[model samples]
Target: MSPASDPNARSLVQAGFSSDPPVSNPVALRAYRLARLRAELRARDYAGLLVTDPINIRYATGTSNMQVWALHNAVRYAFVPTEGPVVLFDFHGGLHLSAGIETVAEVRPALSWFYFIAGAQAPERAALWAREIADLLRAEGGGNRRLAVDKCEPLGVDALRREGVEIRDGQEVCERARAIKSPDEVIAMRRSVAVAEEGMAKMQAVLTPGMTENELWSHLHQVNIARGGEWIETRLLASGRRSNPWFQECSDKPIAAGELVSFDTDLIGPDGLCADISRSFLCGQVTATVEQKRLYGLAREQIEANIALLRPGLRFAELAERSWRLPETCRPNRYSVIAHGVGLCDEYPHCGYVEDNDRGGGYDGVFSAGMTICMESYIGEEGGDEGVKLEEQLLITETGVERLSRFPYEEVLMPSRWL
Candidate 1:
């Protein structure tokens, strides 16, 4: 049965329960996000803005699904000026009834609202909708002004250009605003980590030799779904020789006795925040694989060491560089980076050893409070032999870093007492 259908699943579904707390509306948190977006637009010197990214849409409107697609192909957008309530272009009909939730328009009517066009895209209708949206901006005292557009897919941008609208890049401004976590966002993310830890704990009790990677992945999905998790971001289960850092995709190979199984579980919460973690286990009796043990040890050490150094005022690239240096036990591969920013998207402000001049590469950006990062380090042999990967989620605080997920990191599975 689906988790929502099960009565026993209610506790996990509502994991972040608090008693004797001020009853704040979820809409208040949403309003804060919209206010932040407006401030970003003003700082970037735009009269108004168009937010096309899905994540940005969720940020502006509390509705998280794909209802924005109904915006008459005119780019699902929120146009906010220096002052006044924001104008939202979205589909209101059917969405409210289907989702069983009030539309943003009903919640905040002070903002100008337009519903999705009902008919097919006749050129005339498209032009009319475009003109109407532009006229709304013009009525708000923004005439022929350059507007900041966030993540406008090529087709949307071309359509707007055809309609005589000027669009400028607003990626950096949006990224800077989204990089830091809010108090509510941090709490949601910690809850996601806790759910992942619970799922991993269950996995440790059942994992054994002769299980296929797919089978293990299925078990994880079942456990997570039972705990009210909607989806898993990734299920990377690589066993034995496939445990190398280069091996990312899950395989169907059966796990054998005395082989090391390395897996990374990245799961997402209902709020869209994520938690990424990696762990390794030995299937039967412990073998004298000194290199494997040492590699795991190094990965663990580097993760902890990097966490110790994480704080405000430190450059992001410096932390990455310090963690990428391989120990004498195992050789580092060319494909992987140590860790990266984890939030609305899996890899935001990509951090690691590799340098991408287009996007600031390695250690250049300063670490600030409220940044939630995943500190991961992995080492493997040259020929895709046995390897190890260790990762954990950390919150950078004013004084120090706090580890959110505290599951055991040893190679031996505690429940079975088998290494």
Candidate 2:
């Protein structure tokens, strides 16, 4: 968004709302997200939501601190009631981290009751934690005892239950709330994708034979940190034979010429948005083998054909039924989903294959405008020595889908004629 359009953008920078570039209007973004979360709660008859998952906390408060550590530590949380103040429970000495943010109504010291903090006293401390939560609910709940918690340990759950609190699966509500993106969130996502593409461009520019996969993947990490990005979710860069089955981590094995180097940019880029695009590049300046080009071509075809099926109001089941048909030989190693929702990170509404029903996997939901998703394609024969991974992030718009990831495909391996 234009800085001139948002009068508060400049002031927010000076106020330390964020140290990175202002990619979106922070005020509107936070307000929209909070409202959305509340609506999701009200829809489910929930009195409030207790957010302990670090990612959910970020979504609720727009403040981040040691997220990876807190993922397991349980030392931070937020409480957003359907009709009351949005309270943030921050770690000790961390209240200043969200000082001037407008989404948070109050910042209080968090109560840590994890084993690391309380050990054998964990159960005792947990009772204290439960009392505080129960008191807040009694004050803010208007007598509604149902609460949705995105994440909590068994101890916390049991304690809350004993306090007459009905615990609901809060992660489901959070996912539904996060599936839709506001205009500012889309703008932020675009900027994140741009940062990822810049790093991919650098990787391609410097790619050479004999360079280890670790060396090549470091370029993405360096670019992400150097830019305003947060982190890369995986080390999914692999070369040649290692790329065949997919999901291989980057190793010290040196890449060879003519081999396909496939990678998925599971990047948490600038603005903490995820840029999840995948591409395969031919290593060095050499002609790709016919097999390499064939794999790349099939993957691209699958991406295009499946993307063509996306539109607002489409049923997930129908989309999965009509998705590009994987060849018989490649069926065993197909990607987990035809597509899946992507926002803060890879998230809900996993669009799996229609045949996944036997595995007890199927959910009915209609694709709505403002939902950003990543469509994935991976092609390789069961015993092939190489594979190609291709994916694209797109926005489901009122009219149709808008491709968000614009990183160039491997021209050398792409067929002259492509859809």
Candidate 3:
């Protein structure tokens, strides 16, 4: 059946809210993000941020070229002070790559020790990089003698320490900055959700028995790329027995008729926001078994109940306390986390089970306005090799939350007893 003709699909589409004109405005989006970061740094008394994490660098400077390469080799980095210029230490000789990015003040070579160490002569380059960073920190007002480095090589950190700079964990600053979503960030995320749901709709339209899990998985990548998304972070698509306990990466196994298929979209879209969503599907025209229906229903119950309880000012600890308890049969294989904050990727404020949260950092903080949260649940019977996984992305507002995911659930898999 065509997606539009399916009642479940129609209902989901109708319930999703989108604006008349697209909410993506690149200029405004970048400004909002940088402003938020600066605010966070100011609040934390950080002199300047030395961001080397590819994702964190992209967050600060808006340049994503050679991202994966920078992860292994610290070739690219960004330094932004609370008040002054934004600098891009461009590696791979890609200085021109940051040409028109408004937030960037200047681009310079990121000649790290790693860049020269293969030929030896490492200390020379490390000193140069350290001197450059020391100067940047001094300019940002070295009263604190502190700089936050998100991710960096040991050579670079040692060099900075020798220069008398106290290095702090920059990821903490970046996470606190990104914990809340600006209006434009929310829009970019919503746009990503729309693109992913379109991919889901396409996959649902043509699902059939005998289709390989790889084939089903390709549909999402193809659709997401065509819609301008970047990449899928994980191989989270599986079918039949593979879908059971979850986290089985997509394989060459062929799907059998009347079996469950589950997938998680760890998709990083064009706007650079990650759309981390999951849904379970029952293969074509098959009647779901009683066990299948029960598992799916329980996951839905858990998700819906938690979503209802979410509101601004609700304590994360209280929410964890109130989370649905998994039945004894399902507790052994229950997913570790109930929810986590989502932004550039699976970020801070991970809300674990009461037992897990009670350890020390129990209840990170109160849910505040403008935070984006992903509620997650996996329901698999301990001994059974089949299960269901459900997740939804939400934007917390002054009053309550808005569902950013609009993909329809599998009606056939849902228990009929549920209204």
lDDT of candidates 1 onward, in order: 0.62, 0.87, 0.82
Runs in model 1 lying further than 4 Å from the true structure:
1-25, 66-82, 87-93, 97-103, 106-129, 285-288, 328-335, 354-363, 411-419
Tens digits of per-residue lDDT, candidate 3, 1-419, equal 43446654442256453322276777887887788888888887888889988889888877887665666877788888877899888876688998999999899987767744434668777878888888888887557777888987787789899988889888888998888887888888987887777777767766789989999888888878887888888989888788767788999999898989988888887677888899999887878898899999999999998999999998888888888888989877888788889988888778888776666534558899999999999999887879898999999999899888877677888887565
What is the TM-score of candidate 3? 0.93
Highest-lDDT candidate: 2
TM-score, cand. 1 vs. native: 0.79
* Residue-level lDDT tens digits of model 2 in 80-169: 899999889999999999989988889999988999998999999899898889888999999999999988889999999989999998
Pairs that collide, model 1:
317-362, 317-363, 318-363
Quote each prediction's TM-score.
0.79, 0.94, 0.93
Backbone clashes (count) for model 1: 3
Off by over 4 Å in 3: 1-21, 115-119, 358-362
Which residue segments of model 2 deviate by more than 4 Å? 1-22
lDDT of 1 by residue, 281-347 (tens): 7776566366666667766667777777778787766776555466444544632555577876564
Ranking by lDDT: 2, 3, 1
Q: Can you give the lDDT of residue 156 in candidate 1?
A: 49
- TM-score: the better of candidates 1 and 3: 3
